[model samples]
Target: MTPDEVIAAWDQPGATASIHPTRGISEGAYWASGEAQAALLAQDIPAGSRVMDFGCGDGRVAIPLRALGYDVTGVDASPNMLAALNRHAPDLATFRSDGSDFGKHLGRRKFDAVYCLAVLIHHSHETGQQLVERLRAVVRKGGILVLDWPVADEPAETNAWIGVTTWSRDQQDQITKRLGLTRLDVDRPWAVYQA
Candidate 1:
C-alpha cells in the first residue's frame, strides 16, 4: 500500500488491527503490548534523550516512553490518529506527515533516536526504503533506529494494508550497508541499528 492508502485504512473505524494486532484481542492486551514495547525501548534509549515515535498511532508506546523520561515527539500519517493522540495526550508534541516533510514540522531539529513500529511492513520495498532514508535524515549521526523491518527465509511483500512484509537476508544486508546502518546486538523484537 502507498502511504496515503495506509493512512486511509488506519483512519477507518474498526481498523484497530491495522495499527496493532493486539487490539483485536483486548484493549488491555493492546495497551499492555505497547507498554512492553516501551519497556524494551527504554532498555536501550538513554534517559532524557530526544526520541521520535514514527507512526505513533494514538500515543500507545509514546505515552509510556514519555513516562520513562524520554522526550518523545509523535509523528503519523493519519490526521484522525493524531487527533486521537491529542485527546489522549494533549501535551505530547506531534507532527502530521506520511513519513516525509520532517523539516516542515520540526524545522532544523534532530532526534537522538527514532523508533518505527508497525509501519514499514505496510509499504512496498521502494517506498519503505524511501521512508527509511527520510527517517534517517532526521536523526543525528550515530543515533539509534529501532525498526520493525523483518527478514524471512522466503522473502515476500504483502499486498494488504495490515499484512507483514519480509525481506531476504541479503536484501536486508544490502539496505543496511547502503544506509550506513550498523546492526546492533540488542535483545529486542525489532531490528536495532545505528546511523
Candidate 2:
C-alpha cells in the first residue's frame, strides 16, 4: 500500500491505543522524554528553531517543546488527538492534517526538527517509507528527525485491535537508510534519527 493508503486504513479505531504511564504513553514520562528528545535535538538546532511535531498526539512533545522555548507546530491525523492537544497546548501552533502531508499543509516551510514518536507504526511499509520522505521534506536539510515506534519481528498490513498497520525493524532500518538517515540509537521505547 502507498503512504496515503496506509494512513487511510488507520482512520477507524486506529487512534485508540493503551497508554503506558511508566513509558512514553504516560503524560509525565512522555513529557520528560520529550524534554530529553528536545535536548538531543537542540544540539543540532538552535533554541528558536522551529519544530514540526508530526503526528503529535495529545500534545506530548508539543507542550513540552513549547515550554522549552522552541517554536513548535504539532500535526496529527486524529481529530480526537488534536482535540486533546487543542485543550492542553492552546498557545502552540497546530495543524490538523495527515502526518504524511505536512509539506503541503505547512507550505514550503522547513523545520529544524521533526519529532514523531509512536506515530510511524500506524503505517504499512510503503506508507511508512513515504512518511519518512515527507517528513524529510518537512525538515530542512541537516535537520533532526526524532522518532520511536513499536517494532515487531514480522511486518504487518493490518492490526484489527488498533485498526492500523506497521513495519518491522528491518523494514524501518532499510527505509531510513534509503532516505540517508543517520540512526542515533534504537532501544526499545526509544529511537532517534537525524538527517
Candidate 3:
C-alpha cells in the first residue's frame, strides 16, 4: 500500500485502532510502562536492545521498553494517539510518520529489533511482503523482527487482524528466506524472526 492509502485507510481508520475485548489491552494502555516490562520478560527480548515500535499507540510497548532502558523510538500517524502516549510517557520520543516511510525519522539509527505488531496487516499480504523488505532494512544484521498479527485470510472486526491481509505459512517462509531470516516459532500472538 502507498503512503496515501495507508494514511487514508489504516492510519486514519484502516489499521487496528486498539485491542478491544482483550482485557490486557486496557491494562497495558493504562499502565504501559509495567505492561512493557512484563511482556518482554517472558520473551528472549534482551536488555538494552535498540527497539522501534511501528504504529506504537499510547506506548503500550514503547513506554515499557523505554522503562527497561532500551533505546526505543516510536512512530505513529495519529497525533491523538501520540499525544496520549506522551501523556503517560513524557520522556518518550516519537515521530509522526506513516509506517511506509520511517526512514526520515529513523535516519542512520538502525535498530537491534524492529516490530510492527498487527500494523502491517492493515494492507494486503503483497504489501506486507514489501513491508518485510522495508522493515528488514531498518534492522542491523542478526537483529530480531517481532512481527505479530492473527493468522487468517480475512480481517476480524473485533481483533487486530480482522479485515487485514495476512500470510500463509508458505508466504511467510518465502519472504523470510529472501530476507535471510530464519523463522523461530510463532509465539501464538506474535511471529518471531531472527536475522
Candidate 4:
C-alpha cells in the first residue's frame, strides 16, 4: 500500500489491532511489550538522547521510552492514533505526517536515533524503500535507525494494509549500501542500522 492509503486505513476505527493484533488482547500485555521494546532501544540509543518513534501508535512504545529517559517524540500519519497517544502522554511531542514531507516537519532538527516498528511491513517494496530513505534522512550522521523490516528466502511486497513484506538478504544489503547504512549486530527482533 502507498503511504496515503496506509494513513487512511489507520485513521479508521479499530485500527490499533492492525498495528499489533495479539498484543492488544490485554492492556497489560500491550504496555508490557512497549516497555520491553523500550529496553531494547535503550541498549543502542543512549539515555536522554533525542529520539523519534515513527509510526508510534497510542504511545505504546513512546511512553515507555520516555520513561526510560529518552526525549521521545511520536510521529504518525493518523490523527486518531496521535490523539490516543496524547491522551496517555499529553506532554510527549508528536508530528503528523504522510511520509512525504518529514524534512518540513523537522526543519533544522535531527534526532540521535529513530525507531520505526510495525511500519515497513505494511507498505509495498517501492513505498517501503522510500519510507526507509526518508527515515534515514531525519537522523544525523552516525545516528541509529531500528526498523522492523524482515527478511525471507523469497522477497515479497505487501498488497494489503495488514500484510507483511519481506526482503532477501541481498536486497536488504543493497538498501543498506544505497542509504549509507551500516547494519548493526544487535540482538533484537528488528534490524538496527547506523546512518
How does residue 21 of candidate 4 score in lDDT?
54
Give the winner by TM-score. Answer: 4
The residue pairs that clash in candidate 1, if any, are none
Clashes of each: 0, 1, 8, 0
> Candidates' TM-scores?
0.95, 0.73, 0.77, 0.96
Residue-level lDDT of model 1, residues 1-195, one tens digit each, is 777888888989967555677888898888898899999998888789999999998989999899889999999998889998899899999989986788888788889999999888889888888888888888888898888988889888878887988877688778878888888988788888898
Number of the top candidate by lDDT? Answer: 4
**Per-residue lDDT of 1-195 in model 2, one digit per residue for the tens?**
444553454454634344224453565675676667656556555688788888777776677767778888888776777777888867778887776456567778888888777666655656666777788777777877776655666656654323445557787788778887787754434566778
Q: Where in model 4 is the C-alpha error above 4 Å?
A: none
Clashing pairs in 2: 3-127
User: Candidate 2's C-alpha lDDT?
Assistant: 0.68
Give one digit per residue, the lDDT tens place, for model 3 in 20-66.
Answer: 33434566454654465337533755778878787787676777667
By summed lDDT, the worst window of 10 consecutive residues in model 4 runs over 15-24
Could you give candidate 4's per-residue lDDT for residues 89-131 as a string of tens digits? 8999998986688878898688999999988898888888888
lDDT of 3 at 107: 73
Stretches of candidate 1 above 4 Å error? none
